[model samples]
Target: MGAAITRAQIVEVADRLFYEQGFEATSFADIAAAVRLSRGNFYYHFRTKDDLLGAVIALRLANTEAMLDGWEGATPDPVERIRSFVRILIMNRARIMLYGCPVGTLCDELSKLRHVAKDDAAKLFMLFRRWLSLQFAALGREADADALALHALMRSQGIATLATAFQDEGFIQREVEDLLAWVEAQRPHQDRPTSETRPQP
Candidate 1:
């Protein structure tokens, strides 16, 4: 395989390892073993552990962009788009419970270690913040767009932290329901989408 392909493979596995085993805990050997790449080959692509971190952060940022874009295409209503964000906790509840939100945990780890790529990992959160702010702006809450977006982000981070700490899926479900209610409340009466139970305009 070409160098580019090998590098991509290493980053992909490193992303997962960092999320699961933690960035500081995951060794080059662990990543190499996972990809079945020889140490020499792995070293050829990533000279230092931080080099692997840089690639992993870039990979995560690209994936986050694609995911946020997918949600944008999934619906026209900004409220529903925001709902999609809330739904991520439900979708990844298992992993969130284990790893306490991949992006959040990584940023925390790198921050503690004073890793150079800390801000890069933080870009993952930045992507969500910007996307959520746009959706709130579309909802005509421009004044509170950033506040609203950050509110949702904070709630999710809190939930992920609690779920991971307590290992409670029930708490996740309850919090998700509450977050969805908050999203529903943000929609204006005229632009609100109706379900079967709700009266149509």
Candidate 2:
């Protein structure tokens, strides 16, 4: 006989399966099979497919927030902090390639679900964008912070897509480095004092 599976284990397996195959493609039976349990046992833990999905979303959001924790204080330079955020994403390229960014993929899949889940996914992205905007504003760039935040968010998603399409980790690393350099160059220059225009009678 196989070892007994707990509710947490079932949810963990479901999360991976959902990430790999999407919510519609992964079923209770599939999750049960992975956990070596029956559909009835899976139901005992989750009650419904939506319930399982909610659990997955909650878990993913918590995990992502935890990863981003303390990131603000990681460096004194705002530009360095922004670069660190990108580096974190690049370092997790393999995982992102495997499961996709939870916020991005979940938001894409949200339309199929009811209101609460959709709202939660949307809120998660908003929070992410807000954080990026603050980081860009701190860099003292003259461009609109919202625009910069959107660009950064889009670049991340675009790089993840490129990784998925090309199956190349190097592509993301190269592009992230280039993007960081461009952002750094956008910082505003301090104005210099005029030489002979002031204090003349």
Q: Quick one: RMSD of model 1?
A: 2.9
Relative to the true structure, candidate 2 reaches a TM of 0.78
For each candidate, give its TM-score against the true structure.
0.93, 0.78
What would the per-residue lDDT of candidate 1 be over residues 58-149, giving only the tens digit for each residue? 88889889999999998988988999999989999999988889989999999999987888888899999999999999999899999999
Model 1, poorest ten-residue lDDT window?
A: 192-201
List, residue by residue over 134-196, the lDDT tens digit for candidate 2.
877877753688888888888888888777777787887899887776566545544212332
For model 1, the stretches where C-alpha displacement exceeds 4 angstroms are 193-201
Candidate 1 at residue 161, lDDT? 94
Clashes of each: 0, 0
Top candidate by TM-score = 1
Best by lDDT: 1
